[model samples]
Target: MKLVVLGAAESGVGAAILAQKEGYEVFVSDMGSIKPRYKAMLDAHHIAWEEGHHTEANILSADEVVKSPGIPETAPMVAKLIAQGTPILSEIEFAGRYTDARMICITGSNGKTTTTSLIYHIMRKAGIDAGLAGNIGHSLALQVAEAPHSTYVIELSSFQLDNMYKFRANVAVLLNITPDHLDRYDFKMQNYVDAKMRILQNQTADDTFVYWKEDEHVPNELPKYSDPSAKCGFTDEAQPGSAGYAANGTFVVNAPVHFEMPLSQLSLPGRHNLRNSLAAAIACLAAGVSPEVVRQGLSDFPGVEHRLEKAGTVNGIHFVNDSKATNVDACYCALESMTTPVVLILGGKDKGNDYAEIMPFVKQKCRALVYMGADNSKLHANFDATGLPTADTHSMRECMEHAVALAQPGDTVLLSPCCASFDLFKNMEDRGEQFKAWVKQYGEAK
Candidate 1:
């Protein structure tokens, strides 16, 4: 069997190794440059690969292709493969074929990371064996091939969910869906929502589907036919006759195993995170993890690095690295979570962002705006109507410098760009790391 691995990054490389180990003839092809480390691995494992181009002959000859989640199905090569009747699968799907571990998959627009991490933390605290993979770190295929665990908590993006067919999560979570990655989804909200709903595909009546009851997307667009025998809903706004909801400064999960936690004690900030934690707790409960473990995990889980991370303070101004705020809705969560006045750094490759959603918060909490990106004209057009003070910076350093000068002692300089970071930095992680390094020298906050 010939397995062609598309792309040569983490997921691709991992898939290549796993396919080769599975006694298949694996060839990794990347249209972009493959990192030296991954290239070295290919050579070390004696696995064949080609970088800088995807050779049509080699790719077309494969029996199956393992695609990176970042590669959209619309890519010409992918379209051609589909036309030729070649089965294309995501790294997660390809990996799922080798693992017997029960997958606990989580997906959503805004809070999937928080929820995934929260569930993993809860499992560890509860003394259950679990491994984290998928959209976050090590490729699931690689993990399952090398060090298999009994339970896997995987973060599923819409792209990953798209190529997945029989890879069902024993307990699936959909935090909430919103308008995001519309360009990839044909600018249709339903398209993206439907892709996210695929996390529950192939799930049996014995499985549990966890979702948010109050999200407009859930009660409206959610497919009832995809119902697992059990349903658990998490909400901060809904009345909880059963399941979970937030009330009186606490999140209450009522059911087979009663759970409640003070809102203030949650390690993660923001109402979105509160809802995310609630959803994760419900998932853990459904998985049969104990309440004590859930409580400990909710209280002590270290938040994801790039999502609303506190970089440092200089001249009494705090810098927050929210490089993960890649959409308007994610940015809304960052702005709404601010306690101190914010000097928000915003701009990037606009993914058809509708800035109107965050205009109210920008006008109220934002003391100043530092627009970072080459094409910040869209922000200007949308923000001009808001009358918020705005200035432009072509680079991240300039944005940070101007932000420091403009910020007061008790204010925050938030690098919460409401778009993808490719325009300025290599990726969100690179952007976030640069923010952290620069803030280390700033002598403002302890």
Candidate 2:
């Protein structure tokens, strides 16, 4: 069969490689310049690929297409393919077709990376032959092509879930749903919610759906499910019949075998992380992993980078890199986790964020605010009347300088932008790495 892959980055290149390995006629195309390493791979493998432009004729000849999650459905090329009645599959869907691995897929607006990593940690601790894929580690298609494991802990995004149809998760984890990435969803909450619900699409009675019980959008959506038995719900607050809950600094999961651990033992902090812990633990237990393994994984997991990761402490001021906090909700979690007064770095490509959601936390916890992005007018306007000292800058260096000036001995300098990083940095990881680098170079120098 002719297989065409779009956006020749990690996932797309991986899919092309897997398709070629499976004896399919493969062609890869990217509208932007393909990275040198990826171009080399295509050349070495003798697979056909093109960069900086899409040849419509070549792409149109495919029997199937694998699309990278980064591409929006609204792209002219994609829309043209849709008009031609050609089916498009996400990298996860294309990769899933070739593997018999038990899929443990995790998705949410936030906390997904942490939960996915934690689950992967627990599965390995249990001596399970597992591979980390999806949004976190290597591309699933690449892993399936080279060394496929018996199980996979996949960190899925709503974009990845959108094009997935027949791919079923043995264990599906829905962390929470909030207003995020609405621009891609036509500025509709229901559309974004529908995209997230696709994770449950191919699930069956034997499959487990572990989700956050307290999420505002989840309960309303749960009624559509015909079977409640498949659900393993969790909450940070007490919910008597929930599969997991946190109380008195302890996280308790009542499934497979009852287990409990003090919240103090959890490597990640904040109430949001407590909720992430519950979802990961319940999913692990449902996968037949012992409670002991879950406990060990929860305790030993250092934490995922860019999600409230501690950069360093200098002159009694703590620096935190939460560059992954790309939405109002994520920033709320970061703010809530702060024990000391915060010199918050906020602003980026605003995703129609409602800053009102975080205003309460900001009023209570924020010592000063530094706005950094291609545009900072919205933030300055919204925060000006709050009477909390605020400064605006366009670069990460200026952001740190303002933060350093505002920070005191017991202050925390946090880079939780609450918006997309594309305005200033390549992505969240790039933003986070720069934050850490600057903190180490400049902040620690003092």
Candidate 3:
């Protein structure tokens, strides 16, 4: 079999290596320059590859193509492949073919990383030899090739789900559906929603489907056919039949196993995290993890980086890096968690953000707004009317400097952009690292 992999980065290179290991003739192509590590990996494997351009002859000859999620359908080469009816697969789908690992796949506009990490922690604590993959940790294909495990907790984005066909999750977790990446979905909310729903594909009676009961879109879009898999819902309120919820300062689970714990015992912050905790607990329980183990794991899980991570405290002021909050809903989650007055660092590549959703939090919690992005006009226009103090800058350094100036004792300087990081940084991780670096220096100076 001939396999051509697109975008020679993490997922693409992983796919190539797996294909080679599976005895397929493999090739990797990236329109952009391949990272040195990935380039070396391809060379070490003796796989044929091209960088800076897609060789049509080499790519078109493939029996199957595995594409990185970042490569959209609109790319002319991909369109040609589609037109020719050549099979196109996501790395997730391709990887699933070779793994007997039971999959716990989590997908949503928000809270996916937290939920994925929490579930992985619980499984590990319960003595399950589970691997983490998909949008986090190592690529699933790479893990299947080398260090395979009995189970996997994967973080699936809508883009990754779009190309996944027959892959089934033993436990599917849908946190919530919100308007995000609408541009990639052709500006249609339903398109984005449909992409998220693909997580439930191929689920069976023995499988379990976990979702947010309160999300406006989730309940409406669920299949109308007589239910097969155990359908469980998580919410802030523990309804009569909910799989998980919070009630009376307790985290409660009623499905797979009955479990309860003091809500105050959860290590993560905010009401959103409470929902995340509920989802993770229910998924872990459905996977046969004991309630006691689940409770312990939830209590001990440290938290994911760049998602409301604590940088440091200087003379009482706190610095938080929530660089992963790349959309309005995510930003709302960060702001909602803030107890102290916030000097908010906001702005990035705006993804058609509706600032109105966060206006209430801004009014109540935000003392000053520091904007950082190539374009801040939209941010300025939307937020200026609210009468909040705002500053505009083009770099993280300036953003942090403004934050330090605006913040007082007992205040928080938060880096929750509510927008994509492409404008001024390579990605969210880079943005977060710069924030942490500058914040460390800023704190030491005080």
Candidate 4:
């Protein structure tokens, strides 16, 4: 069989190697320049790969294709594959066929990384042989091809779910769905919601589904995708059907076994994090992790970087890097968690975001606003009428200066841009690192 892997990054390279190991004639292609590290991996594997261009003849001849989640279906090459009815699969799907590991999969608009990490930590603490994969760590294909484990914890994105067909999760977790990446879904909420619901597909009666019972979109869409016989668990306040819940400042899990832990002992803060913890606890419990292991893991786990991460304090002012809050709902959660008055830095590539979703939190918590992006016109259009002091900036350095000026002692300067970072940085990580760098530089000068 001839297999062509699209986009020679982590997932693509991993897919190529896996296909080669599986005895398929494999080729890798990326329209963008492949990173040096990925290029080295492909070379070491003796795999054929092309970068900065896609050879249409070679790609169109594939018996199957594994596409990187980052490449949209709207890409010309992907469209051609669809038109020709070629089988297209995500690396996760391709990797799944090679391993029988117990899969613990997580997806949502926010809190997925933290929840996925928390579950993995608990599983490890309980001495389960586990590998972390999907969107958070090493690609699943690479791990399956090189170092397979007894179980795998995966953090999936909507894009990856779109291409997955036969993959099944033994323990599936859908944290909460919100309006994120709507641009990729053609600005339709249902299309994005449908993509998220794919996590529950191909489940059996023995499989488990964990979800946020209170999410606006989850409840409405649950019946459409969830298997009737699959065991369903929900995160909510302790109730008749709740699998995990928080009540009286205590986190509780009832299914698989009864368990409880003090909410105050959880390492991550904020109401949103409380939900994340609940979801993670449910997933761990469903995976048969013991209560003692879950409790210790929840308390000892350090928070995810670039998601409400403390940069540093400068001249009595606090700086928070929330570069992962790349959508309006994520910024809303960050704002909802702020106790101190905030100078909220927001702006980037707008993804058809309705800023109105966060206006209430902005009015309640923010003292000022800083717009940082190649274009801030949409931000201004939405926020200029808020009657708050605002500054427009095109660079991180300028953004920090304005935020510092706007903030006072005891104030917090938060970088929770409610839009994608592509306009000004390589990605969310670059945006966050730059924010931390500027904060450190300013602190030293102070």
Candidates 3 and 4 compared by TM-score, better number: 4
lDDT tens string, model 2, 178-271?
9899888998999999899888887888989888888889889978867433888887777787888888877888864699988898887778
List lDDT for all candidates, in order.
0.86, 0.90, 0.91, 0.91
Model 3 clash tally? 0
Residue 142 in candidate 3 has what lDDT?
94
Find the candidate with the highest TM-score and give its number.
4
Tens-digit per-residue lDDT, 246-288, candidate 4: 8998888887678888889999888889888888887888888
lDDT of 3 by residue, 205-290 (tens): 99999999999999998854344789998778867777888888888888878988898899987899998998998899899888
TM-score, each model? Answer: 0.96, 0.97, 0.97, 0.98
Worst 10 residues of 4 by lDDT: 225-234
Runs off by more than 4 Å, candidate 3: 224-227
Q: Write the per-residue lDDT of candidate 1 for residues 1-446, one digit (tens) a residue.
A: 99999999888888989999999999999999989999998899999999888899999999999998888888989989999999999999888889888889999898898789889989988888899998886778878878889999999899988898878789998988888888898888888888987877888887888888888777676566656547777668547454787788887888546978888888887788888988888899889988888888899999998999988766677889999999999999999999999999999888878888998999899888889998999988888676666788988678888888778999999988989888878998888898888788555333
Q: Could you give me the TM-score of model 4 versus the true structure? A: 0.98
Off by over 4 Å in 1: 223-226, 237-242, 444-446
Error of 1 at 205 (Å): 1.7
Candidate 2 ranges beyond 4 A from true positions: 227-229
> Which pairs clash in the backbone of model 2?
none
- Residue pairs in candidate 4 whose N, alpha carbon or C atoms collide under 3 angstroms: none
